[model samples]
Target: MIEISGKKILVTGGDGFIGSHLVEQLVDAGAIVTALSQYNSFNNWGWLEHTACLEKINIVSGDIRDPHFCRVITKDQDIIFHLAALIAIPYSYIAPQSYVETNITGTLNICQAALENGCDRIIHTSTSEVYGSAQYVPIDEKHPLQPQSPYSASKIGADAIAMSYYNSFGLPLTIVRPFNTYGPRQSARAVIPTIITQIASGRKQIDLGDTSPTRDFTYVSDTCNGFTRIAQSLNTIGKTINLGSNFEISVHDVFHLVAKLMQADVELFTDPVRIRPVRSEVVRLWSNNSLVKSLTGFEPVVSFEEGLQQTIDWFLQPHQLTRYKPGIYNV
Candidate 1:
């Protein structure tokens, strides 16, 4: 079994959703984890601030786009988990160039640093957004990359750059591609949180965009487990693997399920601002999880209903629900 014991690991963007959870799991597995957040004036650690494992990690604040910072922080690290990225598709439309700089160039910096430091492994995080809409059911690693939006295009670029390092310079790295990951501590901008926050805030009318698009949502913890497992698999280096539940659900269906569980009467209204341009929207996403299972013996441990219930309960807390502005259409 892949053991993380005593490994010196650096988690870029460990302050964010999946990254923070990964840090906690890695620490519990006995890895000496270093958590890095984007340098902010307020010194906020994002969700990492609330983690009970906070004291066990070495927290640092710096931007990965800075080459000097990337090189400095990655030095002497045993493994590097690169999770930093500008993930919002709507935001990418407004700032496509920022996505290129952060997603592509920032990734370049990390790969360079990892190679220079002689890091044992570099598990670069990738999103299924790179695959855009599924051209076919059970989209596998070989799926053609359709850049339906600026966000997916940048990730495609970033993934290419990462793999080149392994092919040319022989940098030890594995591309961990996860389908829609959702759970507690996710940003309000994500769909699961968006729906939960609006319902929790007593909004009878929920403002949403197109609800026809289908996504394969994997729980955050399962995605993290995939990363840790990939790191432990020596044969997975210089390869790309997927972490997903191999199931799919459309937005409309997902909303209905959430409403039933919460017993909340919420009406959906399509907001123009929330809808993606027709061509830019990914109409469907279904993951082919066989590769990950074959490689790492990893499968989602949590059922969709169970995970959703846990998520709904977390958002029900007044203090947590208050953190999101349900009325505002978060892009």
Candidate 2:
């Protein structure tokens, strides 16, 4: 237990999937958390709106692309967790420029703001997508990056920009790359959410893309802990550490296991749109998380089957299942 009591922290993208979970944990850890959810006319906080802790924390609505707002928010903060970005891979194909602007340019703003505010630490959230396909099994921090998709290319750019801040300005920034995080409050755009929603909606035929690719899926809570662990430890400054379960499973195997858990015999149908371009597809991804374990003693607490069960139960709720379009493919 790292003591974060009375520490002022800023969490960008605090409305989204993993970000919301981080906010919940930060609050429990006794931090004065300021959560920045993307601004909307509907005033929707996304997943954070449902959190019981929302009433106790400061929720700011703004876009990280605005450098002025970023600078203003960083003032008086002890730590910054930058996570705002466009993450849907399929949409990135159509809006590559948007991905660059949000992921790269937005990161630049956060880094600059953190520097100006003299923030003690800035934990930049990165993705394993920056490592397109596995050149070798159990990819480590030294793995070569080959961006196989537009989304991945943008992330690579973002990671470089973040590291530059550390190298040039001596900013105390750490990049935490989490692999394939899945859990409750996740959007239907992800594979786990897609499968769970389809089954919850009583779909007899589930739509899917290529099932050959493998991924290392970490639960949301574990991923969140990695961020806090890096923040609390001074040894992690200027380091790019991984937060993963160090386990791999194919899409086909995951779908089969999920079906068994639900006791539903569903058939999978191939969708051309759901499939990545032939060369752009990453065939496998497995994490080598020993670096993080050595630095922070961080390990995933939730087992795959246990996490899957929790996600399934949450999506099974009538209101949550209704939010997803089971019959249509989500981009």
Question: What Cα-based lDDT does every candidate model obtain?
Answer: 0.92, 0.91
Q: Per-residue lDDT tens digits of candidate 2, residues 222-289?
A: 88988898899988999998889999999999999999999998998878889999988889999999
In model 2, where do residues sit more than 4 Å from their true spots?
none
Q: How many residue pairs clash per model?
A: 0, 0
Candidate 1 structure quality by residue, lDDT tens digits, 204-281? 988788999999999889999999999999889988998889999999999999999999988988888899998999
Error of 2 at 291 (Å): 0.2
Q: List the residue pairs that clash in candidate 1.
A: none
TM-score, candidate number 1: 0.99
Task: Kindly provide the TM-score of model 2 when superposed on the true structure, using C-alpha atoms.
Answer: 0.98
